[model samples]
Target: MAIFNTRDRTIECRIVYYGPGRGGKTTNLEYIHRAFRKQTIGEMVSINTTGDRTLFFDFLPMGLGKIRGCEVKVQLYTVPGQIRYGSTRKLVLKGVDGVVFVADSLEVRRKENMLSLKDLQQNLAEQNKNIFKIPLVYQYNKRDLAEEGVPIMPVEVMERDLNSKLKIPSLPASAVNGKGVGATLKECLKLTLHHLQEELKWAVQDGL
Candidate 1:
């Protein structure tokens, strides 16, 4: 759920980048921070935990305009994808308004991607959130590896494996090179803000 500050006329929401370990979740954030300097509000904070790190930063999108007369402020975060960090991932996912699942494109990581997605579903369920209903996007990352002659899953296969049932928006990306990073985030933000608007409408109707 997004926090609406009636006094400040601003709404703050969280969007988490989630996927298997070394799946380029952090890379997406890093690229965004570097590429979208005008929108980035603060330093990208990282919390290191053994083999993985959790990162977050604030972003204020310009052209999306206000929601219900409140300026929208977004906080982007990346959950440590290592399986051992399940608790941390759940904590970060709390009160999430949207999600970007960064699925690795490497052929060897096919099962890992599936497992991470299942982990996400379970974690969201624990918070009384429905993965199916939530604003979510799939990013098939590391497409550049294919140019290096590395084994990578075809976009169609990745969709069938991870997104066939969800049928959400999915984009092929090379996060390290900033390819599709903006587009991925842009789509997620659009969906999230639209979802928030509907929620706010319902809340107002219910006299909340």
Candidate 2:
């Protein structure tokens, strides 16, 4: 979950961008970093290795407005999407309050998306977070390639494949050109707000 420093009167939330390797996970965060540089509180940090790269960036999200008189700060992150980096994916998801699953559109990556989604579920389960219940968003990234007979799984196909049971917000996105990026974020922000309320309620009851 995002770190909200109530002692310091700051609300911080962690949102993880997750998908298979080369799914544009990094590209999505980079787009946000560039698009909101003025409002971003820090730089986008990428820890690159020969195997994979993990990236993170933060933004003072005014769009989420105020919750209990505290403004919301969003920390965007992406795990090393490579399959062999499974440990790293779970590590990065550690305290995630929200998630953006960036699925690749290429026809060849269909199984990869399915695998990544399952990986996400397993990783989150290790932390007691449930995809069926979390504040989640799905970005069918690389939508621009839809016409190329690429994986371009129809929205319904993805829904059936990934979101059949859980009805989180999903959008067609092109992270390279920034289409649907902000919209995807806004929807997640709303879900996050609702999630926080649920969390607060549980906290009131000592996590029930």
Candidate 3:
């Protein structure tokens, strides 16, 4: 849900980074926070728990400047990827406007990736939202691991598994090293803005 602050002429949109445990969802946000330091509204807030993984969520707010006279503010969040944090994940996605599914490219995480995607769909359903209709992007992260002698899933395989039905653009990324991270985020923002535009147009038509 995008919130429009009429008095301030600003629009605030929430985008969530979601995936299985240790799949680089938080890394993506960290990279953006560091890379776009000037646009960052505040320090990135993170809470780690078991095994030093995210316990709740990571938040980073950004200012994207004015769009058609309305200042665009984006609140980025990453859900705790651990399976035990299912309820926490659902809470983080409460008013999400877009999502970047950061699927780990490690061959061993294939099953976990699938399960996380299913969980996202189920949670969205519980909110009365259609997963198919939501603005979403896929990121095949941890590609750099392959060079370290780690078995990584091929981009083709990842796409086949995660994007076959969603048909959204999927980008290969190595979030830790900043490769493809910006592009993945850019695509997500583009799709989200387009969705918001259509929504605004519909509202105007309804008022007419």
- Model 2, span 1-208: residue lDDT tens: 6555666556677888888888888888778888876657777777766545543322223224454566667777788777877876777789888888988877678899999999999988889878888888999989888666554677788888888887777999999999988888878877876788666532222221
Q: How much lDDT does each candidate structure score?
A: 0.84, 0.76, 0.90
lDDT of 1 by residue, 111-193 (tens): 99999999999999999999999999999999999999999999999999998899999999999999999999999988887
Clashes of each: 0, 7, 0
Winning model by lDDT: 3
Q: Which 10 successive residues of model 2 have the least lDDT summed? A: 55-64
**Rank order by TM-score, top first?**
3, 1, 2
Clash count for candidate 1 is 0
After superposition of all CA atoms, the RMSD between model 2 and the true structure is 4.3
Runs with alpha carbons beyond 4 Å of true place in candidate 3: 202-208
Q: Which pairs of residues have clashing backbones in candidate 3?
A: none
TM-score of each: 0.89, 0.85, 0.94
Per-residue lDDT of model 3, residues 89-187, tens digit only: 999999898999999999999999999999999999998888898899999999999999999999999988888899998998999999999999889
Candidate 2, after superposition: displacement of residue 55 in Å? 8.5
Name the candidate, 1 or 3, with the larger TM-score value. Answer: 3
